[model samples]
Target chain A: MAGKPGRKFQLNEKQLGYAMVAPALVLILLVVIWPIMLSGWNSLFDYRLNDPTKSERIMTESLNLEEYADNRYLVEQGVNELSEAYPEGEETFNETWTVVQNHHEELVAEDAMASSYQEVNSMLNDYEPITDDNLRIQSIDGSWGSDFEAAMDEQIEAVTAVQQQADGDTAVEIGYLAAQLENLQGSVLSSNFVGLQNYADYLLDGRTWTALTNTTFFTIVSVGAELIIGLGVALLINRTFKGRGIVRASVLVPWAIPTAVAAMMWSYLFDGQSGVVAHYMAAVGLISDPGALLTTASGSMFSIIFADVWKTTPYMALLLLAGLQTIPNTQYEAAEVDGAGRVQKFFFVTLPLLKSAILVALLFRTLDAFRVFDLIYVLTGGGPANATESISVFAYKALFEQQNFGAGSALSVIVFVCVAIISFIFVKLLGSDLFPERAKK
Target chain B: MLKNQAGIRFYIFLAIFVFLVMFPFIWIFLTSLKPQNELTSFAWFTSNATLESYASAITTRPLFRYMLNSFVVSGLTTVLSLLIASFTAYAVTRLPIRGKTLILGLVLASSMFPPIAILSPIFNFVTDTGLRNSYIGLVIPYITISLPLAIWILATFFQKIPWELEESAKLDGATPFQTYRQIILPLATPGIFTTAILVFVAAWNEYLFALAINTADAWRTIPVGISFYQSEYTVPWGDISAATVIVTIPIVILVLIFQRRIVSGLTSGSVKE
Candidate 1:
């Protein structure tokens, strides 16, 4: 009986515990999971921002001579009727028939021009294809027989039916995509989804690859440099010194400055006439011109990476410093007693202890660098020919500037995959117990 | 003689390190004091200096507005986060919750979730709720951003507190809340201060959410202000340097005052986690 009470009590307790986690779980779903899910679904449709309802139509309006030629055939029949009306004026009738034929052809040419004008008008509606309404494809005029007209009628109806069907299908596909896309990058960007088409177009968009290339390059170089410099700084500051605390504070100042501010600060410094660095480099003849870096592609990338390295190096250093302190000075003392070199002590003890911290620092920084937009946006706006745009920037463009959220969402999905992969790798490399419990058993 | 050689090497190393480290600050300070006209003047060391830029940056904008937004956001975020995290951590560590370790690991893993990925949906949520460009929108995310660290810090600190105190307090018929308030909190002051300072700085320096959520001028922070001020091709460098100095000086002083607590916080923050 006593044990039976315990089971019931445990069930009630488990429910209450779940209630405690409910709020956080709800938040994570609302914020993180929802957007990720939405982006994935949006990738399946053609949602363009420029034309919410239709595609761009380029109609080639060459003149249609078939109608004019058909008028000639009708005139020949009419001429015979005229000749039959007056046999004495038959000679005059023949001369008049030739004139009549010429006049009919000219009139047919004008009507054909008017029809071309109508089709061009339809194409201009952002390629909203006109298939089922007042404009039936008129007959091929000069066909000279009922059989030819019937055949022409059949071809026209068939094309109209197919085009109308395609339009309805495309509209429906865009609609489905638009709904999914609206959730992710926001409907402010796009509201239509033409299936399979956006995917083809995305494959064609070079800006996606441009931003991808630049960002990937920036991430590697910046993270690589920061880790190296940060490790060096951590090692340098590891020893006993008089003013070490003050020095540590100074190192942290850059990290403490908000990244946006730090990014802008460097942007200002790289400007041609106004930047102090530009002026110095110009005076020393290191750079052939002043302020060229801010305006050039290589320079823009350099400025961003430099700013990122400056802002984040201290954070990296702090992580490595913590790792260094964990090495236990006794290892160094033991090495000294063993007549081992400094290099020997560093390799044997320091590197191994710092492995986890170094990885943690890299993981944090790399994820941050991949999602880098603010620094690039405020600094260069991906100017001077798409030099500084990252995956995040491309998404921003799709969502805000151009307003094509389907494509934006597809790019965001790519970013989400990258971050997930990196996080997975981090956990795999560091082992699941990276953040070990501090609870002393 | 060997000691002398080592001492000289140390001094030389210290000299070079000190110079490299101090160069940026010295550059900032010197540039901060320079006249606007000489900002582009090609001289490393300028004889003339003034407090004009700092004075102007303060006078040019509603400096107090930015400071107020930062303080309100940071202060409120710290308080709310600390209360939630402390309670949550305390319950996880002390209570007989089923699978507390699993729950704690889940919280730690939440930090790896990227903020930008969640930006749009949160923005939509806020805009829908009529909280966009408002102080609350900024504060809400700031708390979430700071939550994982807060829970981690408090959990680590709670682990260090002896369980005997709680047991005795319980034997004396003291309620859990009373025990926590009377015994645990007083001893946990160091941890509380460390967590507070860390959260405070983190919230204060947060840029993306603050910029994205608060588009209006009335509710902007220092980072947003600096970004706007950088809109020109030839930016106002002297004023920016002056602004940098203005923004950094307070946090620097805070770090200096709480030097001991900051060290312990750092030591614990990076403790194999």
Candidate 2:
């Protein structure tokens, strides 16, 4: 399939190498690196999806033209009716109407978007939804927007005072007008930008601290257990035996299962009422009762760690088995010649030689355990008072359930920082173990 | 005599380990096969086991559809990431590429980034681009996420290939691309195949992106679909277990068949040859 390349037209090897590698690097930058940077930037603001005022990443005071136009129309109609119905408060109605009309003109002039106002108003009249964000929202001067709000509040207060002096339908009409005036004031949208405030708030938040603690505890305990058990299993599987292939394949079964499915499987086994594992645990007196396994906080933490260990120890064993196989038999023979006991041989020969593999495996497992979401999510759902909530789950709830993007982004950055720190420590500990030639230089 | 005793102890220990590892699946299989009325009882075996749960699981939700979606997403991710990673692995291993160490380190570092950290921005971007429930949306991130490991495994495999063959090909007036396409690719097929299975398993099991990006019921992958099996009141353990068994059987079979290749691929970079 290769066409003949002209000698003068061909790219050099170095350029070709870069050309081949560029697509992957670009994809990583686009999908991974760029998104992380975007999350970091988003963490600086007070953004939310549920709150209309704080929804957009606004830097300046603005006016929501849709709300403004809708409320302005109601106020105009109510004020017209109020003046006609309440002859005694005609002067007050005219004064309030003038103040409202003047403020609307000032807001339009200050924002320099009279066209947007006209468009939104006509759309409202035609009963068409204002879907275009730019046409429905516009920036205005900060101080002027606040002053207009205060003026509207004062007018509403004056109208309320006059309405109190009237009776029956006349007072009812003025009250409705005053309420519309209040809504009109709410259309002045202020900026939601709060630099580092979300991070600051999370730093002070108890739930955030709890989430961090749960994540760290989960990572440490689970990875530690996996290391010990996985090493043992690795040594067992590494030995020469019949059907070793079958054993190795069976070991991968727990790992090969999708994590979400594993969580579901474990949840059934740990089910409070009907779970066999729970029933057996209670029978053996490892837990107080069969139902307590998932219902209690400590039990949940224990259950999750247990399931994680089960699911991932196989992976850890596989990695360590690879490392164990790398050790030549001569080293053990040398140990034997030195009259070393079994324990001494393991501590001296095996553990020493398997350090790199252990580090690599630990690095993968610890990072994985730290970022755990699906297992905890499907099994416990960070439930029973949110005691089992990992930072990832907490972040998921904030981003998706609460629709608080800014707070969620902050939590995401925290997770990134923790992962970075963990990786840095592991790499430092692994120093040159991973790349010996580069380290030698 | 002492050696024989130690061997006996090792076998016993191995048996226990295998039992502990496989018990969860066995228990789930039993649960799936039990009739719905017997699900609440903690029986090791049922008197009347049936395929009722499997029937219910299939009817209650589009389990086959979810499987198909997972296959499409994971399959595309595997093929695309393998193609991209092989080129990268080839470049870093065979060519006189500058910054090879830095490139390898970057690849390793990319894998270390927490997937949650990038979730929000990617979700927003996907939603903004109107690709929230599309295959390409999920496949793109899956490829990016799987690339690092695929590259690492493929690089290790590429390094093990003899350099003399490439030199000989160069002497025979074959261009580098031609040699890579005609010779290197054919030889690296086993490594590529192993990486494909690993990446496919990973993509199939991935939950977060699938949960976030493909919330549409028609586009749900197996993991997300299984997670949504719960109704408003009752938790249907029977149906869930049945679905779990159906989805997990193929993966277990693949892992069993390719045990040696998968192990070698996993351990390749962890140790020096």
Candidate 3:
């Protein structure tokens, strides 16, 4: 096959290279990049999944046909019933009833929306669910939406006046009609595109600022503690000693445990009432009271940072240990021969040689710490007044709990920018090239 | 050379270090074995021990099912990441690529992107596409997020293999695929093993995506499932600890066995320079 030129139909090496890498590249793009772009798009709108009116971003005015069709019929029937029950306000009721009917007809009579309304009405009549997005929500003209909203408001005011003139059941019926008209008015979905207003709001939002500050505080403290403690552990383990393997393996146990499980364990340990660790801390006078670790804001933050350090310091140690192994013993021996004591040797030989490793470890840990979520989420639930809420926790609350996608995505984007800045500082400012060896060439 | 006090001091420091590292695991184990009645007590140690919590942890909820879910998702993630990453790593390191450093840097940078930053969009995607609660939903992010680390590990290992072996295989008329399968793979087993362990641990421990993407109980992994104990009637400390122990065992075992390889894997990717 090799002897004959053009006999084999194999892809050339470069083509093969591209072919091999294409799946991974495409996967990263779709899974990582595409969702981020979607969030960016979402951040531009006032989309809230909980509210039917703003469930989706509406560039053109939209009508919630399901709510509209149901409410329109109710408004008309209720107005007629009220007018008959109270003949004294019949003139006012009748006039208001006609106006609502006219707006309703105008809304259903639109050239762009008439057919869709008919389909939706029939679907609602048949008691079938409108699962199709287009059928459930139909876009109407901008002028029609505003005109209908204005007409409904006038009708509501007229009905409210009529209700005041009536008594008991008649007044209640008129009020019901007015409520239905108000709801129908709400069914008109105007454009929710707030044009980066969510970002502006989040920037000024106190909770956002608090979350950012909490995240920064947590990252700095936790990463600093992890680096110092991890380096010490790494130095200790790097020495040739008996049972070092056992000690090393023991260190990894905490790192090996799932972070959420670790968080859960700490939550138990820091429990105010029955926590053993809390009991011991209180007994030892380190803490004034049992169960105070997770209740107070500062205490909860300290507990979380403590837990994070406990969980990740071993990982830092392992990374630093690798860097330590690379620093040859001859350098230390040379330092010793130069009349350098242990402290002097460590400061001169060990610290200088371990700079790159420390930077790498700090980079990884700092970024990981700044975006901390599962720990705070599981441990504190961002609780006792959201004292421990990291930006990620806040974003989760906005997106899921509040069902505010626009606000949530704005928060998510803020986190992305902060993380990008941290990464930029580490790589560009600190001169910690990710591929440090490659940069030399 | 009477440095006997220094030796004693070193052992004392090591003992304290070992205690700090092992105490949580021991405490959790002890808590898991304690009876339900003892849970409300602030005792340093329980007088009686029982496996009742482990029984409840397994029987009261879908602990095994959650474990199965974690296993499937993590296992699939490990395999797919290893496969995709191995190919990309091989191409980047062994092939005639012009900008290898640029590609490596990009891969490394991708890893540092905040996972939460992409959560909102991923949530929208999974819901809209009806991929919510499926294994593939979690696995998709897991694969991409873990790819950079896996690729870096594999590439560093691939770069160390002498080119002479591949050239000889080519001269013997073996295709690239055959060379990779027969020659390179056998030599790169250690790197592949370490990367697999790392990816599996990551996927198994992943909480945010699992919690966000999988709404159904059937699809929830161990970490997300154990969290349900938090929201239950009262905090089931005993059962939660048991579940934690269940989830932690496999990873602990892997770490115990492959400690050195994991250290190398973590460092070689970052601190090699």
**Which pairs of residues collide in model 2?**
none
Worst 10 residues of 3 chain A by lDDT: A432-441
What does candidate 3's lDDT look like per residue over A9-62, in tens digits? 775566667777888778788877788888888999999989877888877788
Candidate 1 C-alpha lDDT tens digits along B140-217: 777557777787777778778899988997678565556667987897888988999988888987877887689887
The candidate with the higher TM-score, 1 or 3, is 3
* B142: Cα error in model 2, Å: 2.3
Q: How good is the docking of model 2, by CAPRI class? A: medium
Report the C-alpha lDDT of model 1 over A267-326, residue by residue, as the tens digit: 766778767667777788977787777888887788788878877876787778778877
Q: Per-residue lDDT for B211 in model 3?
A: 92
**Which residue pairs come into collision in candidate 1?**
A46-A193, A46-A194, A70-A141, A70-A142, A174-A193, A189-A403, A272-A291
A64, model 1: CA deviation in Å?
42
List TM-scores for all candidates, in order: 0.73, 0.89, 0.87
Off by over 4 Å in 3: A1-4, A63-142, A152-187, A429-432, A436-441, B1-6, B40-45
Please tell me which predicted candidate would have the highest TM-score against the true structure.
2
**Decreasing TM-score order of the candidates:** 2, 3, 1
* Winning model by DockQ: 2
DockQ score for candidate 1: 0.22
lDDT of 2 by residue, A176-250 (tens): 988998888888878888899999999999999999999999999999999998888777667667778878888
